[model samples]
Target: MIKSVLFDLDGTLLPLNQDDFAREYLTHIGAKVAQVIDPKKFVSQLLASTDVMVRNKDKTKTNQQVFLEDFLHKIGVAREILLPVIDEFYETDFVLVKSITRRAAAARQAIMAVIECGLDVVVATNPIFPASAVRQRLAWAGVDDINFKLITSYEQSHFCKPHVEYYLEIAAHLGRLPAECLMVGNDVKEDLAAARIGMTTYLVTDCLLNVKNAVINTDYQGTLQELAQTIAQIIKER
Candidate 1:
């Protein structure tokens, strides 16, 4: 029996255009740190550091450590000097990014459905953002009120999405075999990768994000409304 359900944030639970979200996010953060660092240089180094985090496979360092190590090195700033500013931005200015995101009622319904079935719910968004930022997005999605089994963040994760290791880490955290967890998301590549480790998958198609036009091979595919009902049906049959 499935013991847990993993939900992706960006196009899955939270309705958003990934490109637009990233652009607005960078714009807001860029303005916040403009006084000390040039926005262009800051954005460049940030992207490069994010890439470093993406390619990171060294389980010893969390994605946050890898990102900061490369980011601070290239940006030529001390952690003490820059971290507070970024933290403050997430606390204050990051809310503006919500304007680009739409609230999905089905998201909360789907999560609640999973919870009511006594299954653990995980917000398995790509672990490239600080927890504060991820939580903010969760709030914007209207699903932050409930407790989660795990919320993948750069501080806690060593790998990013589309990497099989990321799924392994989450599975290890939940102490559930991959087969006992159901991966649900909108991305053809990132979220569906969980199937490689024996997990089942449900592709949320309301905001489908198959950018590469890859063939869909998920065990299931449907909109968020259907997902909630599907979970109910799955439990009933069990």
Candidate 2:
């Protein structure tokens, strides 16, 4: 039985021009941290740190730790001086970037379907941001303020998506085997990677991110608005 659903955020639940979202996020975050470090330098170093998080292989260190270790090393800033600034930025300024995202009421309904069936739900967004930022984005998507049983964040994660290990980590965290979970997302590359670990997949194609044009096999496929119906049908059949 599929005991849990893993949902990706960026192009799945939240419709967005991913490029614009990243640009706006970096711009505002750069401005916010400028008081402690040069804005240009901060942005560059932050990206470098994020890269570290993405390539992280050390299960012993969280993505956040990997990011901070490289970030603080590159910029020579003490963690005490930088963490609060970034945390405050996520708490206050990050919400402004929500303007770049288009909302979908069906996204919430889809989540509700999973919840109604009593299946555990995990927000399997790439753990590239802080938990606070993740919660805020979930709010913007009308997901009832972090209703997911688990929200992957850099602080609690060791791997980023498109890596099978990332999906495996989530399965382990949820105490479910890969075959017992369903991964729902719009990205052909990242979201589909879950299948490599034996999880079933539902491809949300409205804002699909299949840049490589890879042929994918999805157990179910539809747009975000079609998701609730899909889940309902799945449950009925089950």
Please report the candidate that would top lDDT against the real structure: 1
- Cα lDDT for residue 224, model 1? 90
Q: Model 1, 89-189: lDDT tens per residue?
A: 99999998999999989999999999988899999999999999999999888998889999999999999989999999999999999988899999999
Residue-level lDDT for 163 in candidate 2: 87
Give the per-residue lDDT digits (tens) of candidate 2, residues 3-81: 9999999888888878899899999999999889889999988888888789888899999888878888889778899
Local distance difference test, each candidate: 0.91, 0.87
Model 2 superposed RMSD (Cα): 1.6
RMSD (Å) of each candidate, 1 decimal: 1.2, 1.6
| Cα-based lDDT at residue 233, candidate 1 | 74
Clashes within 3 Å, all models in order: 0, 0
Query: TM per model?
Result: 0.97, 0.94
